[model samples]
Target: MIQLHSGSVMLQGGVPAPIPAAGSGRDKTMAYQILRRHHRGPWEGQLHLTFDSLISHDITYVGIIQTAKASGLREFPVPYVLTNCHNSLCAVGGTINEDDHAFGLSAAVKYGGNYVPANQAVIHQYAREMMAGCGRMILGSDSHTRYGALGTMGVGEGGPEIVKQLLRNTYDIAAPQVVLVWLTGTPPHGVGPHDVAIALCGAVYGNGFAKNKILEFAGPGVAHLPMDYRIGIDVMTTETACLSSIWQTDDAVAEYLTIHGRPEAYTRLAPEEGACYDAMISIDLSRLEPMAALPFHPSEAVTLRELLHDPGDYLRQVEQRAAEQFGGKATLSLTDQVVDGKLVVQQGIIAGCAGGMYDNIAEAAAILSGGDVGCGPFSLSVYPPSIPVNLELMQNGVQQALLEAGVLFKPCFCGPCFGAGDVPANNALSVRHTTRNFPSREGSKPGDGQLSGVLLMDARSIAATARNHGVVTSAAEVDYPAPAPVRRTFDGGVYGRRVYFGYGKARPEAPLHYGPNIAEWPAIPPLGEELLLQVASVLRDPVTTTDELIPSGETSSYRSNPLKLASFALSRRDPDYVPRARATQALEEARRSGAIPPELQSVQKALSIPDMGRVQIGSVLFANKPGDGSAREQAASCQRVLGGCANLCYEFATKRYRSNCVNWGMLPFTLAEGTDFPGCPGDFLYVPQVREKVTRGDEEFPALLLTDSGIHALTLYLKNTTAEERELLLTGCLMNHYAAQNAAENRR
Candidate 1:
């Protein structure tokens, strides 16, 4: 069991005394300790951080670079890598796949960044291998850009955040309320990193206990777990919706960096005495067991033993709960899996960055060393996180063992994690050890006639299920080796052989290649004095994903093509969204140019207000909780593309989504928790100088009800807008800010 030490104290004498743990009345919790290490001045009660570096995978790179280009970014100041993994099949949207790669190369050369071609490695795997170092921060366009296990305070922010970094703007936010993840005990036999993360998510998600807080993982458990194990647990913290996470470094972290050939980057981080924490969460690793997030979300969990005792009852409850998630559009039946009074799963996969690590897969291999997967529809697939991880697993005989067991091993690719590959047949059930199992993330089309589903289990449970020929089983029933005979070493030169790394060559004259599909962002006007918007799309789901904003599979090709991709905004939910939004855009253009459209004018005349007041028109999205998964910037940019002005929300699912709204020049406004946003379709709500307020760091702004009720005021909080954020708002977007800056530089 993991051993956690609570005796640790502030190591340095000069750091400010740590703030007390919230609700505990105690001053020295783990959160306060780590916060002291990264502590700088309040910088005016809000801090704007310009990421020293940034990253993105195939799923997101094209979109980020395209946004940068549209914003008039001349060159990338910090390092960025574009990996081609999600669009590996080359099946979707014709040449859109290859064209993205070509665009990546040309853009990388033009911007002086790094480019890793498709199939070379998955994004996080490559990032862990090449990007992370102690005390450094990395911003990735992908949601799971977490590398805190490596002592790098890596954050997965939306593409707009990436654009800001490329444009040399800061990540502006209120100093997050820090939370101490105090851990103790080792995970019991058969328990895995997924188990720990799932448990933590369940504990803190429902109550916003750690929402927008910096998760400082500490305690004796910090040094007890192996590096890969820590990495596994660390990546999943994104699902907890925390602002970002960092861990107190020790020898293990040092060893990880040393092995990866960047020992110099390793530095220690911890909280000072009496460090402040907004909350405290205690984790007992010894208590964690083989866990499964049944369906829909990582928080819906049950122990394998608990599920096994009454499989039918448990399965029925899960199916019933899933009905509410699909907008009640479809039925998810799991009770049918009970055959001959025993539950049998259809498939198992241990793949992607989450499960592809050597230590985890090697244990799975040992369990299935000589077992057959059987000749039924039941199937098993193992994917390595990267070429190097795959090779080491090979040399360790894990590959041969799995192959003999009838398991199919795939190359390094993020396809399984985000709907790129291994799509199951309709109505089939598959379990995976991946970062997420969001609906439609498994490459299955929910809007289609038939539907497929996925459940999350550790590599061990997946192997056990594979061993029993897909009959449900828990990893706890079996005994496996704890560690490999020897820790694997890295030999991943595949990228070195293929990718072009231009480390800081300021070649302003380099020509960029733009494909026919690649298009510039539609012109967006400065933030207006008043906003009059129609509710283009209203999502009532628990959490709205970026994928729902703009699909990923075939759309990856169009990511570089703003107008093309924007046409598909909310394509899955409201097929009519693009048309309605485009129509509104015309109305917006008329309003912006002081010319009301004939149709709108006629409608306004019928309402007795022939001349609609001069106001800027933009699309408004109403959602209970949005921005659940993926740090994709398109979630906001697409709305910006469709003439969006602001988001009215009771709350946001992740801090990054809100930041995306600000960076795209869309006002992120929060309504009273229970207040209903009054708009059916054509209703108007006005928020004024939104531009100036956002720039001037006003905590509260007067929003108005644009009706006969006249000028009733409503308050919206800017929360943590920084100076750079204000500039982005004033200039209409980050891109415009950079363009003006670049032009000014040239003029000087």
Candidate 2:
């Protein structure tokens, strides 16, 4: 169903042609054109871009704004939207979630930004309705911030990038390669967008086919799918580890913008004739099947037919993988869910930006109409993307149809996708149409001996399985009449009633609201002359995600308070990480107070560095490859809060995570691929004149590893750091760098 070509190819007469050389300066793909327009700085080798707009949800907006405030932010430079979706449920912490909502409104008023209240709309949906436009670029704090299907180039990065945008700084990066995703043929009856997405992810994720590249969607299939269908597939591109995505716009895209009351935002966007691409991916949509991603990752996917035919083998493989992930702390057995040679699931969910679009929900309602979800442990729930979609569902009678079929409806919250809501019973299996099925994403505590399995499927199959009393049936095996296409009505009144649109109307005199739980950031120290790091944790996973670095469920309530949130860092994956990091922090405090701890006596003797006053002591973490998932800055900031100064890895999984590390003053260090780690948890690594080396743009640093087995020579690398990023690391953090600049200007 998919083919990848590594050689350069040119689009001539709407067909691909083999090119002898890679793309040249004259070759302008659609991504190149859009990026050129957005590029503000010199674009010779790299790009320093400033986006047209910025967005953040509640879980991220609070910290982003706080950083900007500390850097002397007066008003928002561009349009900014703050949506309350991730923490909208307000059931976790006592009054903290609501307090965040109120704080968002107050910040919007004082800083001239927009704020969407809880249940009004999810972050991406709100952007789709009001913010996305052709030829424009947007930056968001959430990883799945893709509006490419709507003719916009949306880039998701950590909050530091958004803070830079808020402060009118540029997003600097090496120009990425553009990959053409050529699609043709219409999808089969049973195939949904998620099925196509799962297939694409499985093809590219493991081999890094599209890593850090722009995916430009073009070809005959763009004209065949509806706007919502294209969006459903586009949002899942984040799983492929790509930088961003965009699609060629046609009449269907124009009509979508017109229906949403923004006709002027629509524009034809297509690659010029003879445009060259660095790589190409060809997909045949008709060959796709209803797919499911088994537990542990979204890339571990297989067709439903393939899974049901041999359920035992697949179940056992998943169980073995879970054992390796959790180290046998909890048991995960999908084998028990099989009965009479048929697979069964205990729960079903259709929610979030990827699965909760209007077309998916409407089609699912039609599939489940007049069919009852049997009253067992199995249950089904649906959440619309926005209040506008909810209103349309009610107007078209889809809501009543689903309600009559024993399907519960929830608000527009992101909890279901990220483990804050809809937790299953111990060891129960859930079939969901959400974004991710990573371990612990369903909110179960494996360290406490509780585990649950989640299989990712499309809404159609989830509805079909619900209709069959949760027998894990496919939509192709069921007979249901297709729903009539209903004209969607854009209800701007919903947002007018709940959302606060304060852009261009800043009230500088407005008082800021502060809740008891909301606290300022802890002080971060600047880089020292010499560095001494103790390895705190070592992970050998093939790819470590941000979810493992810092979990996303109830702990998100303490995001505004850095120290409190840091306490939960790696709580799920490494139960002893926080305490170990804290102990290292105590030792650092003693060193700063002119007293060396007894723990460092052996290290001082080993390195013969008797003067401990010149060396700064902190902790480090080593992983095979880290930062695969979310764009939350807390993944790196939490480590920094607990005296972490460096990360040792084979390579970083995504650019956003590495940016987060640099912006938070952490040394993003990497060792050679086959090199063995020289230090252990209690060992120390000493790097002389580390601050001077980084300031001088040095990539390689020779260091000494002090261990119980004596000292050894180790070499670390810091690659691809921009001048501003290096200064950010040397000056403590992005906020500190900007604060120092403001202070110098004040003195001038």
Candidate 3:
């Protein structure tokens, strides 16, 4: 269904070929055209970009505003939209969730930004409806912040990146290669966007075919896809590890913008003839089957037909993976879910940015029109992307149809996507049309012996599964009448009335509301001449997700409080990590007070440094490849808050996660390929003149690893760091770096 080409190719008459060009035609691509418009730096190896607008959800907006506030932010320079969707349910953490909401509103007012109230709309949905425009660039704090279907380029990064934009700083990056996602043939009936997306993910994710590249979608298949269909595929591109995505626009895109009451946002976008791409991904949409990404990850996809053909074989793999991921802390019994050679799921959800679009829900409602969900453990739920979309569904009777079919309606929230709502019972399997199916993302606590698994599917197949009473039926096999098309209308007033539109109208005198749980970041010391990194946690996992670094779900409520949230860092992955890091922190505290602990006296003697005052002691974690999944800054910030000094990894799973570590002043250290990190808890690495070497732009550092066995020499790499990043590391972090600059300006 998907073909990947690694070699550079040029587009000739809307088709890609290996035609050689005298010079690179990358600048002619639609991605570069939009990127050049937003580029603040000259065309070179690096791009310094400033976005047109910014967005964040409640889970991240609090910490972003706090970081920006600490950096002397007076007003938002761009249209900053703070949407309270992630914490809308407020089912956890008592008043803390609501307190964060109030703080978001107050911050919006104080900083002259827009605020979408709880249940009004999810973050990306609001951006799609009101913010996305042709040739515009948006930076959001959510990983799935993609609006390429509407001709806009969206990049999702950690909250620190958003804070940089809020402070009018450039988002610096090495120039990215653009990949052509050429589409052809129409999608088969009952095959939805998630199928194409899941297949695309499976083809590219494992091979790194699209890693850190911009996916420029074009070709004949573009015309066949509706706005939402393109969006559904574009949003899931994050799973492919791509930096961002953009698509060629057509009248359908123009009509979509017009429906959203923004006709001016429409503009034709296409790759110029002879435009070159670093790689190409050709997808035959007609060949797609109803797909499902099994437990744990979105890349673990298989056709429902194949899964059901041998349910036992497929389900046994999931059970084995669950056992491995949770380390027997919780038991996952998926093989038992197979009844009479058919897999049975307990729940179905069609929600979030990737799934909760008008067309997806409407099609699902049509499939379940006259069929009942049945009074069994199996249930179905639908969440509209926004109030406007919900109103349109009600006006068109789609909502009533789903209700009559026994499908429960949910608020316009993103809880299901991130494990805050619609969590299944232990051992229950759920098929969802959500952004991800990462383990524990469905609100299962393996540490507490509660586990559930989610299978990512399109709304159509999920509806068909619901219709069959959760027998895991594919929509393609079910003969259902197609729903008639309705003219989609948008009620802009729904947002105008409920959302706080305070952009460009800052009230500096307004009091900033602060909940008790909200706390400012603690003081972090600057990099010393010498460094002492104690290995606090060692993870042998091939890739450590951000969810494991700092869990989502209930822990989201404590985001505003750095220390409180830090307590949950590595809680799920390494339950003993917090205490180990705390112990290392205590050692640092003692050293800062001019008393070197006896535990490190031997190491101090080994380094032959009489004075340990120049050495700064902090904890470090070693992982094979860390920072996958969410773009939440907490993944890195939580480590920094707990006195983390550096991350030793073979590589990072995504660019955003590396940026998070740099922004939080963590030394993004890498080892030589095939280098084994045998260091464990209580072992230490000492680097002399570390601050000097880093500021001097040295890519490699020499350090001595001290273990009970003996002393070993090691080489650590810190590559591709910008000058600002070096300064941040020197001064501790972004906030400290900004504060120092502000102080210097005041003195001047």
In the order shown, what is each candidate's alpha-carbon RMSD? Answer: 4.0, 1.1, 1.2
lDDT of 2: 0.90
Candidate 2 lDDT over 89-157, as tens digits, reads 787788988898888899999999999988888889999988898999999999999999988999999
TM of each candidate vs. truth: 0.90, 0.99, 0.99
Higher TM-score: candidate 1 or 3?
3
User: Candidate 1 residues 1-748, lDDT tens each?
Assistant: 2222222223225232233324332235343333334445564546567665788876577777777777667889888877777777666777767877787788788888888877778888888999987767788888888888887777788887887778766666665666667777888888888878877777776667767777788778777788888988888888888877878888888878787788887877655554545555778898888888876677777788887778889878877766665555556777888898777889888888788888888888877766888999899998888887877877877788889889998877777887767887876788899877777677666555445677888988888888899997888897756555787587746667888897586466877666677676777778875566666776777677767777666666667677777887877665667887877888877776777778666445433442355356787887778888888888788888888878877788888888888778887777667676554455555565555666568878766554444434567666656666677787888777777887898899
TM-score of 2: 0.99
Q: Using lDDT as the measure, name the better of candidate 2 and candidate 3.
A: 3
Give me the runs in candidate 1 sitting further than 4 Å from their true place: 1-42, 70-72, 268-276, 481-484, 590-599, 602-613, 686-723, 743-748
The per-residue C-alpha lDDT of model 3 at residue 428 equals 94
lDDT of every model, 2 decimals: 0.74, 0.90, 0.91
lDDT top scorer: 3
Per model, how many backbone clashes are there? Answer: 18, 0, 0
